[model samples]
Target: MAHYLPTIGFGEWVTTVGEVVHFTGYERPLDTLKLADPRDVKLGHLLGTADMIAQMADRCYLEKCRDRLYPEFVLGGVALPLSANGDRAIKYASGLDLLRQTPEFMMETRKKRLDQTFNQAYRYIEPLFDGTNPYLDAIERSLDFLKQVLRSESWRLLRRNPQVFAAQPDSMTNVRGLMVGYFKKVWSPD
Candidate 1:
């Protein structure tokens, strides 16, 4: 199962602005950071990118983690200590209650965050019920857009319907093995 944390994490250092700038890895040569031109990456944008990535990743991970860690999550395996900057603190709000305290998007109030005729009714909850969420839809659309161009496609479905492949009575085989095992207990005849 995907693990959910109330806290948000970004990229895959998964990452942070700090990690992105000073990253050392088996794939991307670490030694090159010093020599390479950090162009195409502004200092501000790096932080924003890390923050945006963390938020999006955190949001995705939340659902995958199955709400067991609801209202509190850690992105990219990051702790994001309480004392971290606004960029980081926003990354750590365990509850929407403290969303104001979170440093994301300069939002100081939930009212501002949900600025619509019906905040809870329309902006937030409606889409979730109808499978039209901005965050999720964005990810799916982007993936589809990218896959069309990339020669080799690596499709992955966590805990949802699989539309790409042909249906089979043994759809369980398409899911994770552990989930299949769980289903055996709950779905099998007593």
Candidate 2:
């Protein structure tokens, strides 16, 4: 039986069936456990690479950056204390709320988080490709694309109403799909 773990970023479900693991909820199926050589070191690296790309691509990052993270920084036990009944005081609000409250601060916070998370990964992963790996080049391009998007007015609009752009495809997510395809391509029986 496959027991489903709590949904993580991007509504993905991590399921464990005995010793096998599955990733569901992606537009494309990710059956990493069924690789020809399950113990391959490259497999782990590829998965990590894909995961980092997916995280940056996720729309929820904006929401999390504001609703969860910003509050933790701005609100406190004394400034915005918990309820008298001990209930959580910081109720979850939309990204627009954060933007409306402090647009400049929110933009700075998002940029900082992106630098800390995505840029750090890029620095670590860049050398592994040695300038020849197409996957690595693709990742770098995607990272550049994301950085450009972050500076755009569209990103602010995205934060305000993600649903408006829901129908449109995300380039980062496409890059993740490309990474997965490359992983399969590089997986050899030898």
Backbone N/Cα/C clashes per model? 15, 0
| Candidate 2 to truth, TM | 0.26
Which digits, one per residue and each the tens of the lDDT, describe model 1 over residues 87-167?
A: 333343332322222333322211332232112222333355575556434544533433342334222332333232346
Score every model by TM-score: 0.21, 0.26
Candidate 1: Cα lDDT at 37: 35
Candidate 1 matches the true fold with a TM-score of 0.21
CA RMSD of each candidate after superposition: 17.9, 17.2
For 12-126, candidate 2 gives per-residue lDDT tens digits of 3233232222221122334334444444323343444456445444545455554444444333332233588964454334334443344344344235432432233334555
In candidate 2, what residue range of length 10 has the lowest lDDT sum?
16-25
| C-alpha lDDT of residue 170 in model 1 | 48
